[model samples]
Target: MRVVILFGSEMGTAETVADSVADALSAHDVSVYDMSDFAVDDLDVHDFHVIVCSTYGDGDLPTGAEPFFDELDACAPDLSGLRFAVFGLGDSIYGDTFNRGGEIAAEKLVARGAIQVGEHARHDASTEIRPKEMARDWAATLPVPALTSA
Candidate 1:
């Protein structure tokens, strides 16, 4: 299956976690990319999308994903045939806005016609929830069609 992994990070912790997730997916033959380096206009090319972005400041999407998010909001793609999942990294101490960035991204994707496969994952760095574990579990649950031998 064609899977895309997009992530945003500040101090690189989230990026490191995203890399691990990508490596795991690659072992399964899935393609992945860091949101900062991935082409946003090519979002329509993927069959499945996994978003792993971190919230910064007072609930803002990391610097790398802001432009893409804006484009998505402005020209909402018709993603009726696409399936997606989201994993958000944030600190619960932010109170009301904790993980709001990821929440917004997921909501916008749905609004633009993407089908969410399962529950959105919110991993709190300030809490007990581990982002890597959550990402691994989330990837394992994706409805990717079984690979067939040539």
Candidate 2:
């Protein structure tokens, strides 16, 4: 199935992670786009999606992602046939808000009727973990056929 990797970041960490995910799914038809350049209407039900996003201040969506989410919220498109997975970057030091950006994205997508497949992966800045590798592994485990045949 075709896969699209979208990223949202301020300092580009999420973009880097998204690149790794693309590499991991290189065998498949894959495309990567920055959230700032992608529109909500671009979502295709036939394709699988991976969202790589980093939480900004107070666990809010990064600057690059706000516009896309705003548009999605405004359009409120029915994404019932869309399938996706999420990988979030955050600092656990923030306790309650850790990885909230991904959480918010997932929530919005689900609210629009999108089906999320596989695990919701999160990378904590407080650890020495490598987000790119983590994201790549996470992408590899996504159920590509989950909604493609629906």
lDDT of candidate 1 over 1-150, digit per residue (tens): 566778877667667667667766764556656676775568763557778888888898888788777787777777776778788888889899899878877887888778877667788888775777777776666565432333
Alpha-carbon runs more than 4 Å astray in model 1? 146-150
Against the true structure, whose TM-score is highest?
2
Model 2 lDDT tens row, 1-150: 689999999899999999999898887788999999999989999999999999999999999899999999999999999999999999999999999999999999999999888999999999987898788788878887733454
In model 2, which runs have C-alpha deviations exceeding 4 angstroms?
146-150
TM-scores of the candidates are: 0.84, 0.95
Cα distance off (Å), candidate 1, residue 34: 2.4
* Candidate 2 whole-model C-alpha lDDT, 0 to 1: 0.91
| lDDT against the true structure, each candidate | 0.74, 0.91
Check candidate 2 and list the clashing pairs: none
Q: After superposition, how far is residue 44 of candidate 1 from its true place, in Å?
A: 3.2
> How far out, in Å, is residue 54 in model 2?
0.4
